[model samples]
Every structure is written in structure tokens, then in C-alpha cells.
Target chain A: MNLAFRDIRHNLGRFVLTCFGLSLLLGVVLSMIGIYRGLVEDALTLARSPQADIWVVESDSRGPFAESSRIPGDTREAIARLYGVSAAGAITYQSVETKYGAKKLRLYVVGYELDRLGGPDKIVAGRSIVRSHYEMVADRRSDLSLGDRVPLGRNMFTVVGLTENRVASSGDPVVYLSLRDSQELQFELAPPAARREMARDEGVPGINTVNTVIARVSPNVEPDLVAKAARQWKHLAAMTQMEQEIILTRSVVERARKQIGLFTAILLTVSTVIIALIIYTMTMDKLREIATLKLIGAPDHTIIGLIIQQALAMGTIGFAFGALFISSVKDYFPRRVILQPDDGLALAVAVLLVCILASALGVRLALKVDPGEALKG
Target chain B: MSLNGSHTLVEARGISKYFGEGDARVDALREVSLKVYPGQVVGLLGPSGSGKTTLLNVFGCIVEPNTGWMSLDGEVVYDEGWLRSDLRRLRLEKIGFIFQFHNLLPFLNCVDNVAIVLSLAGFSTTQAKQRSVELLEYLEVEHRKDAFPAQLSGGEAQRVAIARALANRPRIILADEPTAALDSARAGIVMDLLRKVAIDQNAAILAVTHDEKIYDRFDRIFHLRDGYLDIEQERGVTEMTQD
Candidate 1:
């Protein structure tokens, strides 16, 4: 008769409701994991987008993402002249908050030289920046349209192009500008600060510094070798493309990863505890029936089968619902949420194992039931 | 009636059962002995705490007797301790039990309640179900075979319970206060059904009850008091039968 299925059928409403409740808890857990993955991906988006073979920054600085690094913009010329260096581009990065309509928009501003390697690869709409001073390429997430003028510091820049999925480690949309404009916007002092410096007889700081100088090696040359050569310069530090990504993941987004992992572990534990409590309660509700079953000479496995099967059913159904829920709504989340099939499969296996461990309590209680209880009035 | 040639289905010799220990010790049964033959419906009558239920449990192999041997269908199953390692299997194959309440599994319909016993004894599902339907029809509750226990009337539930007990075609049936919850008319009907089942299946039936109204339905009645079967009642009954 498949007593476990029969019992669930008999109480279909309550059983479904229980599975639904469990699914909601599981859904939150899944979304948290996806969010963590998104954070890491977002953190590496700009780093990967540049596609440079080597990165040269100021000595002793992890930048241009994890920490601040400032080297003269002309460092690109020296790097471009180096052996095995095919091309080099000086770039500056700074976070800017400005008014977009009535809402505040945060953007990671990138300044690169014209005809350089550090630029948006995929322009989904409009055209790439044509003019050097005021034209910009903005990510679609910035909600800026072509020809929309956005004021930054002392100048208003027009959005000439649009990109997608381009964001900084902090989840801020990215915007691209000419190196001259970015350096002036990021390093140049405001008019008031410049005036104060002039009154104090100190010369205005040069607006010719950049955060990083990215270089691409020749086809036959090793990028690590080029980076090794660049590292010998006392005033410059260099890393291969792989090392930059490692630093961004390990240093920039490490805490967020650990936090999400802790949350996932705690949620799974809570799920185990909740499932155990629910299975225990369900077993308690059927003690008399179990005693009756035992009195009828039912094998111990039959009773144990009933409890464990119910727990497994709950876990399977709950995980299915949670996976469907998270998959359907991931795009609508504020940050990009990536749900990989491998992650879902891993969680499904986890849920199944957790259910088995959870049902132990119920099985123990069922085994302890006295068959003689059926004889009592 | 004197047993002359009929096969004994259930027999217990000098069974004793106790509970607790030392100053807190109490004897629930003392040197109880009896025999039941096929086609006989015997009744054990006693007041509350008189150990009639305890004796029934001992006969059913649910409880171990402190000192005694018990046999079922000519096999010596208990000698102070159980002779079989799998008491559950022995009970499943040899004994059937009915309780004070119907004790029908609430989740299972009437036919399934009856069929589960046969299933546990390794009958194929189809075979178990076929036997269940036949038993339910025999008990005249086949009309409610699809109804869950909660959906059936009290008498209907008890009939289903009886169908379950008879599913395995066991040689001996042990019932504890089987009619205690029924109205007088319904109790009489249940008792009549039990008697009919015993005669039809040629199974020995032992019922523990306090209800005096169904005493006429029993072929022989034993009185228990303070953990002992009253020997005078047996003698008086024998003398009355001779007269």
C-alpha cells in the first residue's frame, strides 16, 4: 500500500503546506548563494573586461581595484617601448555619485587614452565616444540614454554609447571616458581647492597621474616574462592578467564570499533542525497508529520507511520549489544573480542528505513505541 | 464442555507475570492456565485491574510470562522465554489481535486497513487486497471498503478491524475489550460477528471484556480476579452442563 504515500495523500493539504513553507526557507538560502556568486562576478567584471596581458601600477600598491595606485600617465609610453610590449594604455579609475533625474546614480568612472585597449568591448546601443573631452560610454544599468549630459565635478559629459553588465566591484555601473577627461576629473583639484593652493604659494598638482598602465605582450612573448621585467623598475609594480583577477577575488571580494558561505552553512543547519522538528512532530502525531501497526506484526522497517520517506519527500519537493523560484526571479534582483546548474545539483544532494539525517529523530521515536499501547483503552 | 478430540489452537500452562520490584512490586498474573480449541469462542471476564488484559497479552505473545510455557497451533512458542527469535514474525503468522477501540489506521481506507496485515505477512498486494475484499464482504462491511476509519460509523470501524484480524487466517485471535466502546445493541452485534467468525473459520477466539450482556455469546467463560482464574466458576459450569 506504500503507507508513507498513503498518509501524505490522506493529509494532502497539510503536507503541501509544509513543503511550501520549507521551500520558502530553501529559496532564501539559494538566493543568498547566487548573490554571492554575483558579487564575485561583478567584482571581476571590469578586471576581466580590459583583457590586458600585464598590469603596471605604482610600487607597493595592489590597485587599481583593491587599493589606490597613482603613476604618471606617461608611464604608458615607457611600457609601450619595453621589449615584448605590443601596446600599453594608461587608465584612471574613480567612483562618482551624481544626480540622474531625481535619483542619485553611482558610477565607476574609467579614463583611457583614445584608441586604447582599456575600453568597453561590447557597445549594445548608440556609438562609442567620438569626441575626447565630453563624450562617455555608460553601462546600461546607469539608466543613462544617448546624449544625456551628466555633470561630474567640473564638467558635463554626454553619453555617447551604452554597455551591458559592466559594473565595478562595489556594484556601481561603469562609464568610460578619454584619458585626458578622466585624469582631469579624477586628479585635477576643484576650482576652490586650486585657488586655496595658489594663495598658499604651492603649485597646483598635475592632473597627469593614472591609477594603472595596462600592457599587452607580443604574440610570441610570455606575459609573465614582460610583467617580471616591469617589476624590476623600483617605481613600478606589474602583474599578469591572472594575478590581477586573483587579487580582485582574494582581496576585493573575499569578506563578502566568506559572509555568504557562513550564511549558507547556517541556513542549511537551520533547515536540518526544522526538518527534524517537523518529522518528530509528525511521528508523535501518529504514535497510536504506529503502535497499532506494530501490534499487527508489521516489520520494523515498514514503520521506519514511513518516516524516512516522508522526510525525503519533503526535502525533494522543497528543493524543487526553491530552485524554480530562484531561477525565475534572478534577473529582477538589484544585483546580477547567477544560478549555476552545478550549484543547484549540489544543493539538491545536500537537501537529500540533510533529510536523511533529520529523519533519524523520528525513526528513533517510532522504534521506541510499544506495541502493547494498542491494547489500552 | 470437555475437550476430547478437537485440536487445541492456544494453550498456556502456569503463566505468571509481574510488574516493578521490591516494595513497589505487583503481580499482574499468577499461575494462569487455560486451553482453547478450534471453533470455540471463549471469554475472559474480570473487573478493572484483575489481570484479564494481562493474560490476553501473554497469550498474544505481546508480553513475556515470568514462568510458563505457551503453545499456538501445536507449536511450543514460549517456555518462560520466547522460543522463537523473531517474535514479531511468529505473531504475524500465528496470532491476530483486536483492540478495545477499532484501532484502524486513520490514513488507510477500510480495505487497506484489512489488507496491510496480509501485506506484512508477504502476500502480494493483489492477493492481499482480494482477501481483504472477501473478508470485508464476509463481515458485511464491504460497502464501506473505500471509506477511511474516521468516515465510518463505530460498528463499521469495528467490522473493518475484525476483517483486518482475520486477514492472515490465523489459528488464534486475541481481543482485548473488543466491545467496550459500543452501545448495547452494537456490542451484541460485534460479539455475534466474532462468534460467527470463529465457527466459520474454525479459529479459536479469546476475548477479554467486562461487558456482561454478551456472556451468552461465549461458548465458555472464565472469571479472573486478583490475577488468578476462579476455579469454582469452571467447576460450577461443568456441573451445570452435566445436569
Candidate 2:
């Protein structure tokens, strides 16, 4: 009964071909959105897993995630002495390449106090790093199973615990180590340098330094107040957990988000133009038919409805196909592609809006066709 | 033949239509006066650009004439270059148009092409389709009702279009070169069908064509030359038979 559906059915092959092209374009757009979201999720997972309310870093620094901020490991005790600070732990983060078997595995090595507010939030396998040295907990994505021995700088550690989906914003799997061993490994001096320093009457080698100190405020006290109180220490800068996340997302990965956003806008604009051109061409092909309809006294709204109905159908069909395509092959992608249902719904709505906007060109062309053409035509 | 006599269904007096502005202007119709009576089939003949199409447009209420007094179904619809009501609604409710080509919607089948007019007139889909079947059967194209416009033969397509024009049961039917695409035999068939429809429904019909073979089929004929009336003819039954 609907003219749009009738026309599409009449030209089923061409309609399907157009929808396929649209679906491929929509699939790429959806993947970009997923990549952007996945980066944000990866960034947040590590921040949320530690469950610390505040971070205390070296003075005049943005913290370890955004920039290097090495402070004395004893800063944990200073932050723990504050009134509302229930727990504090010195933490270090560094990217390291370790050998699994024959392949090199890149990991985000996180050194945390085992008894304090830093470690994996959930353990799916054996146990947390129990030994003070030569013990590790690996994320499942690292392809390391429990009971495997991995060699890092100057030591071989046994993987005792396993976690899943714990990764850095760069998509590297996270591996946990005891705070002491991590600090020693991160700032270890080469044997030659150590002997040279000894001959030159230098002090002890760099061993007791950590990237930052993480703390959790007592439930009754506001974390912001504790952070502000800790800021009074001239040797350190204290930030609440929310502030650290803002820094990570807004400053640390700001450029990536902006580039992806620009690409998304260009894709959407291209989609709109392509749809307009296709619909306009379709209207042109039926110029005489439209003129005849006009001469037969068809209302303008009816003609408009034909164009918009076709547009809306194409958009809805294309979005459905795009969502299916991205979800089915997302795992094959090197980086995580997280497609949430809300984002899919939002994209569907956007596609519909674009379709409606694109149909305007066809509607304008159809309305401009003079009914008088049917007389001699 | 509802009253067994002539009753005016459409009247146009001194209707003029001009295009462009000033030095570039050209008059398409120059004070063209015309009448169509119920149960009659009128023909308009002219060479190319002689204003026959313009006059049809004026009668169909598609283009406003520069100067005109037009009445339809006893209502003063157009007076001196303006419409008294919505022209689109007037055309939908009271006038049917058949073009040079069949002009059937290519996407729709023959039945749907006819039923669309009834749907536009506010009939439910089921009612419109039922009425469309009856109309196509009346035009002797019931067997081709389910075929798409592209699938239908030329003669069949024209019959479907005529059925569509009559689907609204309007008081007047205006056809422009309706038989131009058909051969002599097919053109005779279409001409006969038009005559039958006008007499059966008591509706006035006006057709513009240049088919000499079908000249005797018209109840009245008007010819135009250089945007002016050139000749008028009305033949008796005996003369029509002789032709």
C-alpha cells in the first residue's frame, strides 16, 4: 500500500545493493565509536580496580598515569598519618616486556602494597602475589596461566594469580608485583654504575623510590578534604580519585579522543551527502512519474512521505546490518572494541535523523517537477 | 444521459494565460471560451504550441488563467484569474485527467494504479480495491488487473489509466492525447471506450488529439490556430456514420 515500499520491492536488487554499501559505511562508524569507548573503559578499569579514594604524588606533577612522579616510598607513612586517611600504599607503574614462552609479551607492570589499598580488585585464579619477591599476578589477556614462571629485569617470577580485562589505556595487559620487588626492579642500578658510584663516594643506590602513594579516606570523611589536607605537605601533591580519572581521560588521552571525534564527524557528513545524492538520483529517474502523480491531484505530503519513508527504511536496515557486522568480528581486532547497547541505540537514532535530513533533497526535486509536464510528456 | 438532454458540467469564458514578463511575455491562451455538457465527448485539436494544452490546464484548475470566468458543477470556482477554493481539492474531487501516455505508476499493478485515486478520495484500502476491480472489469481489463504497469500491453495500460481517471466518478474528465501512442485499431477502441464512459456516467469528457482516423467519434470538436479558435464541428449521427 505504501508507495515507498512498493517502489523498493519493484527494484529489489538495486535497493539491496544500496543498503549493503550503506551498511559497510555504518559499520566503520560504529567501530570508531567502539574504539573510542574501549579506550575510555581501559583507562577507567585500572583506576577503579585499586578502589583508592585519593592519590598523593610528588609536588608539581600530574601523577604516574599522566607523567612521571617519583617520590620516596616513605610518603605512604606520611599520608597514612593524616586524620581521615584509613589506608595508604606506595604504588609504581611501568611498561615492561617479559618472555612468556617464545613470544615477547608487553605488560603494564603495577607494583602495589599487598596489605594496603592497592592490588587486583578480583582474582579469578590461584592467589594474590604472596611472596615478597619473585611473585606476580597476571591479567588473563596476557596469555599467562597460573603456575607459569615469567622473567622480568634481573628476576624470574611465578604467576600465582589471574585477573581478566585489567589493562592500561594503551591496551597492554596489567601484571601485579610486590611493592618492594617492583621498586627495586623499576629503579635498579646497573652493576657497573653501582661500582662507579661506590668509588665516587655516592650514597646508596636508588632502591626505595615509588611512582606515587595511593590512599583511601575513612567512610565518614570526605576524600576531597583528606586530599586538600595532604596538599599542605610541601614535598607532595594530593589528588582525589575523581581528579586523577579526569586527568587520565581529559589530558592523558585527550588527543586520541579528539582525533577519533573528528573522524566520526567526517564519516557522518559523508554518509549524509551520499544518502542525499542517492535519493536525488532516484527522484530524477522518476521525474515523469512524479509529474503524472501531481497532475492526478496527489497531495504534496504524500509525495514527501514517499521520499522520507524510503530514507527511514534504508537507515534502519543499514544500522541493523552495521551493528551485526561489528559485534560479530570485534574480537578479531587487536585493540578492544566495546559496543554497548546504549551506543547502538544512540547511533540508530542518529542514522534516522540523517536519513530524514537526506530525504529533503529528493523531496525538493520531486515537488519542483511541474504537473504540466504530464500534458505533452 | 441522466436527464436525456444536455446539461453544462463545465463553462469557461474569456480565459487567458500569459507567461514571462513584459518583452519576454507570451500569451499561451487568448480569451479562450469553451463548454462541456454532460453525456458528451468534446475534442480539442491544434498544431504544436497552439495552446490546446494550456486550455486543458486552465479547465483542469492546474494553472490560473490571467482573465477567466469558470464554473464547475454549478459552482463559480474561478473568476478573473483566481480560484475560489483549493485548486488541488477541486481537481481531486471533480476532475479526472488522462495524459498522452498511460502514466500509470510503474511500481504498482493495474488494480492499484486505479485504486490509488479512490484512496486519495478518502476510501479505505479494502473499499478502494474492491471499487478498482469493478472499474477495471467495466473497462474489460479485469484479467490484467494484477499485472504491473510495465507488464501490461500498451492498450491495456491505457485502459487501466482511463479506469483510474474514472475511479473518483468526477463530473468532468480531461484527456490530452490519450490515444497518441496506440495504432489506428487500438486508438478506435480507446475512443469508443471514452464515448461509452461519458454517456454511461453522464460525465463530460474533453480530449485533445490529432488522430484523423477517430475524428467522427467526438460529439463536438474545436480546433485552435496561433492561440485562437480556428474551427468548430458538430456532426449528426448520420454524418458520423458516413465518416
Candidate 3:
């Protein structure tokens, strides 16, 4: 018979309460990890959506995600004229909040040329931007349905398609539209500003510009080399697909990753301390019993085994409880918290190691207990 | 049960034990010596701090004496104040201890508490449990074998304790004030059970106690006073009160 299990069964109330408390701690750790992973996914959503091999943007800027980089709309034509460029298009991104019925919705609007690779990677509902002028493909997270009309600037556009996990790094739902329409919506001055400009005899020279010009190299050409060739133009900075992904991932979501990571570390440390204190208290409670076992010819290994087994059982049970609880409520979080099986497995292994280390405190205390005390008691 | 009542199971000669050193030294045992034969129960009686517990501990291999020659079952297990064999294994396989408290593992039922010694002695679970249940049955605690220590009354717990002590059929049993925690009636009952275990299992039983009611139960009685031991030649009997 397992002494550890029997002891736990004998004290079921305390054991359950301990496990419940531990589960809450584990749940917080799991949530932080999921949030970090989700943040990365969200950051990569915009970057990964465009399948172009290289990005051409204003010089000294990282990219559209981490830093604002606007290039002339004619840069697409220049990039297309390059020797290894197979496809090139102009795209711009800007956040806009517009009145939809009684609700105000914030949306990340992206302008992509029809022939470019900057469309939503997966269309879950309706169709892609089929009509150039007033059609939009929106992330399902925007809560927009197909055929729903949304007012932007001076025109009303209809949602033509829906996609999932296509939100920006800040969790703003993305809306896709034609490059020319988006440029007009984002770059065009307000009527009052335009009136002031005309009165001042100043021309709106940059109204036709786009934030970025993306290009795809031919099959046999290297994107890095093509990107280097694009960088030769002093007016623009260039990034290969890998560099763009790295910048977006490292700079766009770096703070969220660190915050979540720090929170996770603090939680795990708290868990380890709690487990150590609990195991120590439990072992202290069994001092007499352990001493009796020792006095009665029970080996030291058996006593240590009992403590270690109980610690491991509590950790595993807590992990299971936390995993189930977090999985059930992940969708309720305002920010996406994606709990993948791999992260759960990794956390479980880490918790188990912490348990083993935590149990050492109890085992050491139990080992030092004098068996002769049992003779007196 | 191949015990020949004439053969001595345990012998300790001139065992001297002292605590501390020099000016602060105090002798706990002063050349104490005793021999126990199979199929008999010996009682060690003393007031508190009379060195009775110290001698019992020495004989049980829980502590080594400053100077002593000790043998169990005709083999010298300790000499010159040092243990000559594995004391833990010797305690597990050759000697049994019953404490002031029953000391049954509270989490384990009566049968498991009894079976653990056998299990630790390399007996398979099935064999250990079977032997343990049979021993409890012989000790008249079979009905309470499934009950945890807390659920059993004082007499029942003591019976289970005895069952645990005899599970391995050890040659020697060392009991320290085993009846002190019980009422006069329960103490008599526990003493009777210990005597029965001694005779039936062909084992030598050594018990330390102060209960006047159960004085007549032991086959031999020794008294301790101020770190000195003496065999009581004659004693008076008294009627044990029952509740």
C-alpha cells in the first residue's frame, strides 16, 4: 500500500484545498504563457499575411509594423523594373475608428493592390475584395458580418469577406481594401486643412503615397540579394521576408513578451515557494509519525519516497486542474490567450521539476527527525 | 516457531552508558546486564528517570552503550561500545518494539500497520498481508483489522500493536511502558495479550512498565533505581481493577 496516498486520503479536505490553491497559481502561469504566444501570433498576423519576399520602405525605417515607413506610390513601378523582381505592389496601413450604427468600431485598415500578396491569408466567410471600390475583407474579431456597411472618411464600404486571427498586434481587427481607396482615405487632408493649404498656396504633394512597397523575387533569385538591390536607392530602406518577420516579432511584441515572461517567472517562483512551504508544513505535521516509522525499522528511503510522491501528485493534479480551467476560459479573455498543447506540456514538466526541488526541503527535515523522539511520545 | 525455552535469545553484559562528559557527566546505566530466554516475558519496572528506558534502548539497538558485549540469537551484534552488524536490519528481522503509545500509523488500517514490518523485511505484499491478518486473528483483533488506529479503542490498538510486533516472528520484543496509556482493565488485557504472544510465538518479551495492576503477568521482573538494575526475587499479587 502507498503510504503517501493513504495519508492524503486520510486528510482529503486539506489536500483538496491545497490542490485548489495550487491550481489557481498554475492557471495564472498558463494564462501568461498563452497570452505571450497569442501576442506573438497577433504581431505576426499582418507581417505573415503578405507573402511578398521583400519589403521596400522609406530609408531608416524598420518596416510598417515596428516603424512608420512611407514610400512614393511610384516606388512599386521602380521595384517591378528591378532585374529579379517578379511581382511588386504598393500597400499602406492605418488605424481608423468609424461610427457603425450606435457602436464605434476601431479597425486596422490595410490597402493592398489587387495583384499584390497583402490580402487576408484565409477567408472564413463571403469572398475576398471582389469589387475594387467599396468592398472590404475584415477580421471576424471586428464583429462585422458580410454585406454590413461601414462608413470610412467620405464613403460607405460593405464588408465582403471575413477571416480569423487576422487582427493587428494591438488586437485591433483588420480591414482590407483597395490600395488606391485606402491611400485616399488615409492620406487625403481634411476639408478644413485642405482649405488652409490652398489659401497658403501649398500643394498636397504626398496624397498619392503608400506606406510600403512589397516585392516578390523570381524563383531562382535570392530575396536577400534582391532586397540589397532595392536598398541601393538612397530614398528607401529594404527588408527581406526574414528581416521583416524578425523586426515585427522582436520589436512589435517585445514588451508584451517580456511582461508576460516576467509575470510567468514571478508566478513560477511563487508556486515553488508555496509548494515548499506547504510540503514543509505537511512534513512537520507528520514528524511524530515519521519518527515512529524510523524507530520501527522503516528505512530512510521509504520516508523520503512518501514525501516525494505526495509532492509530485499534488503538482500533477494542480497542472491538470489549471490546464482544464484555463482552457475553458481562454476565449473570455479580452486579448487572445491561445493555450497550445506544447506549452502546457512544457509547463507541466517545469512544475514537476519544481515539485521535486520543493519536496527536498521536506525530505531533508524528515531525515533529520530523531527516531528516539518517538520512544518518548 | 522452533524456540527451545532453554536457549538465551539476547544477552547484554556489563553495559555501561553515560551522558555528557567530565564534570557534567551522568551515568545512565552502570554495568547493567541481563539475559532473556525464549517463550518468556520479562518486565522492567522503574520510576521515571530511573534508566529503565535507557537500558531498553540499549538492548533494542537504538543506541550503543559506552561499553558492552551484546548478543542476539547466539550472534554478537555489538561489542566494545560499537555495533558489529546492521542494527536496523537486526531490529527489523530479530527484535520488535512496542512503545508507550501504540504508534500504529494512523493512515494505515490495523492490518497494514501490522503488515508493514513484514513488508519491509522483504516479504511480498500478498504474503506479508496474509501473515499480518492471521496474526491479528490470533491476537483477537481480526475484526478490527480494517480499522485505522484512531478508530480502535485503547485495548484494540494495543492488540494490533502486539500483532505488528509479532508479524515477523522476531526472537526478541522490547516494549517501553506499553500499558501506561491504558486503564487498569485495558492494561491487564494488553499484558495478557503480550504474554500470550510470547508463549504462542516462542519469543522473548521485555517490557518496561509502572502499572501495579499488571505485575503478575511477567515470567520474570527486574526493577531499576538510580541507574542500577536488580532482579526482583519475590513480589505480591494484587487484583487488577476492570472497567
Q: Using lDDT, give the best candidate's number.
A: 1
Question: What lDDT tens digits, residue by residue, belong to model 2 across residues A225-329?
Answer: 999999998989989999999998998778998998899889999999998898889888888878888878788998898889999999988888988999999
Please identify which of the two predictions, 1 or 3, would achieve the higher TM-score against the true structure: 1
DockQ of all candidate complexes: 0.78, 0.62, 0.58
Of 2 and 3, the candidate ahead on TM-score is: 3
First chain TM-score for all predictions: 0.96, 0.93, 0.94
All predictions: root-mean-square deviation over Cα? 2.3, 3.3, 4.0
In model 3, what lDDT does residue A108 have?
95
- Superposition-based RMSD of candidate 1 using all C-alpha atoms, in angstroms: 2.3
Where does model 3 exceed 4 Å of error?
A98-104, A154-156, B1-5, B21-24, B234-243
Tens digits of lDDT, candidate 1, B1-243:
335566578777888999999999889998888777787788898888889988988887788889988888889999979998788888888888988898999999999999999999999999999999999999999999999999999899888999999999998999988888899999999998988888888898999988888887787888888998874234222222211
Candidate 3 structure quality by residue, lDDT tens digits, A17-129: 99999999999999999999999988887887778899899999997888898889889899999988988889999999999999999999999888576777789899888
Model 3, residue pairs in steric clash: none
Worst 10 residues of 3 chain A by lDDT: A113-122
